[model samples]
Target chain A: MNIRIENLTKSYGDQKAVDSISFEVKTGEVLGFLGPNGAGKSTTMKMITHYLNIDAGNITIDGRSVRNTDMKKHIGYLPEHNPLYEDMPVIDYLRFVAELQGVDAVKLDDRVKDMVRLCGLNDEKHKKINELSKGYRQRVGLAQAMIHDPEILILDEPTTGLDPNQIVEIRELIRTLGNSKTVILSTHILPEVEATCDRILIINKGKIVADGTAETLRKTASGSQVLRVKIQAPSQDEVKESVSQLAGVALVEKVEGSENRLEIQSHVDQNVNEAIFRLCVDKNWVLTEMVPFETKLEDIFRDLTMN
Target chain B: MKTSNATWIIAKRELSAFFNSLVAYILLISFLGFTGFFTWLSGNGDVFFRKQADLKVFFMIANWTLFFFIPAVTMRLLAEEKRSGTIELLLTKNVSDRQMVLGKYLSAFLMVLIALAFTIPYYLSVSQLGNFDHGATLSGYLGLILLSSAYIGIGLFASSLTNNQIVAFLLALLLGICFQFIFGVLANGSTGWISELFNTLSLTSHFDSISRGVIDSKDVVYFLSITFLGIFLSEYIISKRK
Candidate 1:
């Protein structure tokens, strides 16, 4: 199901949680929602789910209003906190939610089995929710949210408390889900966005500050241009002389090297590489490689949020 | 999820949670034990209970029984959801506020009904005594069921108001007691419109009407109004939560 959020605004008294934010999630695509704590990420997800009524805005799912309860069949959600009944066993809990999501009774067992496997809860399938670790609990949350196999999954920080291994596992699962489902994943983990999201909506202080693919965001970032170079070990004078001679080299910085590395930046990607390669060869120094450095996701996030 | 489907799911889960835990059993045994013990022990003899088998015994005992017991049962309904952050989980599923309220209310009502059922032996045993008034006993139970439902709804509203179960329990009890007994007394001591309103607001007056085996439309209306109002507030409060 495709989701369209138009000028959605929610305010708590004088403080606005979601300030007229709007975006769309196409079918069979993953849209990463990035924001810091109190950036209204959870609030926005809540509004979309119709949990917290909109103070101002419109949300439609497949042309039907968000107010339509039947439209919920297309959406699944994993809340940030992963709240669950502590006394309940994993399978039982999923089964309960599955029935609620209107899964066919005859296929209930099969559905829950699929969910358990999909969420990697096979080891502790029968354990009480409170008995599991935070990561396992999160997995259960994901399993329940997706037990119905919804077309659109709205996951709120699906990997918040997991260890590295769990994070990777969940990321892979999310990526796999994205291939066949439309997912809007809200997270503070920027790398998760780059890893799993086809596109991103970065909100800051309740407003959509950036909306585009990773490449678009990187190109739009402040330090989007960088030069990756490998050069022969050189005398300090030669290095300083050749680096300074490049006309468009914004900054020449030595990458602490035992391995002939250098990091450079330029506002304009002119003939800087040619200049560096020529200087290395003219000095009879071995120039192994020279290429433009790709902008890191962290750099783009920092620049966007800071600005 | 379909709205009714979601509500039924929550209700079933809640119901199982109630029975699966020690709280339901504790509520049953304690409410039955205390009320039963008081009804029989207060009399001069075992065979006759304070001169009549009328539900004066049931009403009198239940009046205090609900004070402490209903809180224990209703405390965790919404407060647990709030504490565990499951309220967000429920909300994000697109289950409307009324569904949540009713789902939770139904579970608590069923649990209370279970607890109330244990008192059946009391009704049966009372019959063994002097010519027991089954009609009055049944009506007394009807009154209690109505009264307790209204109280439970209030408890649910209180539970919805905060994340602390203890706070919810106390607030519900305070509201229930104020509406049940204190409102009547206070209304009696005063005069005029304020008195009239408070008199109508009291739970005991309506309950007393039902306790007589005479179902008053006015009494039914009052109990139903409070139940609906409490649930409405519960829905509104939950809808406001983030």
Candidate 2:
């Protein structure tokens, strides 16, 4: 299913939680929603899943408004905290969710088994949810969300409490699910977005500040390339003088308190690495290290959100 | 699936949760124990002392017991879900707010029924001792069920108003007390139209009318209206929150 949100707005008292924002997610696409705390990421997901009413504008799944109950059947949501009945056994909880999702009684057993297997809850399936580790509990949450084979899944901070190993496990699970489903995952984890999302949307203060592939967002945020070169030479001034003269080099500066290090900034459209390498060889400066700096998603996120 | 099916599914889940938790056992034991002790063992009107085949004393004790017990059963129905954040999961399901409210309400009502069902042994033991007024017994059970239904509705509405279980319990109790006895007490002091209005609004008045083995349409309508009003207001609040 494809989701189209148009001019959506939600306000709590005098504060606007989600401003007039609009975006769309196509079928089989994994869209990552990134934002700081209280940036309306959860609010947007809630509106899409029809958990909260839209204050203004519209959200449609495959041309049907989200307010329609029929539309909810096709969308699955894991809320911010991944709430579950702690007293219920994992399988029982999954079955309960499946029943609510309208899974046929005849297929219920097989569907629940499939979810248990898919979410890697095979061992902990019989354990009460409260007794399971946080990682396993999150798996249960995921299982419930996908129990009915929803075409679209919306997960808010799905990896909030998981350890590194558990995070990777869930990331892989989400990636596998994304092959046949349209997945919208919201998280503050930059690596999760870079690892799983086909597209990224950075929302800050109820507005979309950046939207594109991770690479594109990074490039757009940092329009220029940076290179840090450390040379075993006589002085830093010599390295800066030679590198600064290159045609593509935008700026060159000496590393503070380091006579052997020079920082080079290059124009966005230029490949200055080769020029620097040639300059080092021609000037006979022993080049020890020349590393290109790629702007990370973290930098891009901070740049968009902090301002 | 049909909408009613969704409501039933939710109701089933809620009932299971109730039965599986410690609260269910605690409520059942304490309710049965308190009522049993009062009806069969305590006071001059105790069953053995009266030597009557009727359960008037039992019904009176039950009414008082349920005023507190029913709220305890219902306090966590919606409030705990809201506090634990499971309400989001519930509301986002393919179920409507009305279905959610009814599903939860029915679960609490069923629990009250089960508790009331346990008191049947009292009626049985009394019937064996002498000629029993079966009509009064039947009417008394109906009145208790209807009264419990009213409390369930009020409790559910209270639960929906807040996420704190204790607060919900107190709120429901306060509302139940007003409808149960306070209105009737006030009605006695007032006169004419005001007295009649208070009497009509008092839950005990309708309960008394039904307990007399005369199923008055006006009394039944009064209890049903209160039940509907409470459930309707709860649904309204849930929808407004969304």
Residues B162-202 of candidate 1 have per-residue lDDT tens digits of 98999999999889879877999989999999899889988
Least lDDT summed over 10 consecutive residues: which range in candidate 1 chain B? B42-51
Candidate 2 lDDT for residue A62: 86
Tens-place lDDT digits, model 2, residues B1-242: 39789889989999999889888899999999988998889968888888777888888888999999989988998889889999899888888888999999989988898898898889888889888889989999999998899899899999989999999999999999899889999999999999999989998878877787888988888888888998999999888876
What digit string (tens of lDDT, one per residue) describes model 2 on residues A1-307? Answer: 8899999999998999999999999987899999999999999999998889999999988898998877888988899888999999998999999999889999999999998888888999999999998888888888899889999999998898889988988999889889888899999889899999999999999999999998888788878889988877677666778788899899988778866777889987798889988888887888888888888888888889996
For each candidate, report what fraction of the true interface contacts it reproduces.
Answer: 0.71, 0.91
Q: TM-score for all predictions?
A: 0.92, 0.96
* lDDT for model 2: 0.89
Question: Taking the candidates in order, what DockQ does each have?
Answer: 0.64, 0.86
Candidate 2 clash pair list = none
Identify the candidate with maximal lDDT. Answer: 2
Global lDDT scores for all candidate models = 0.82, 0.89
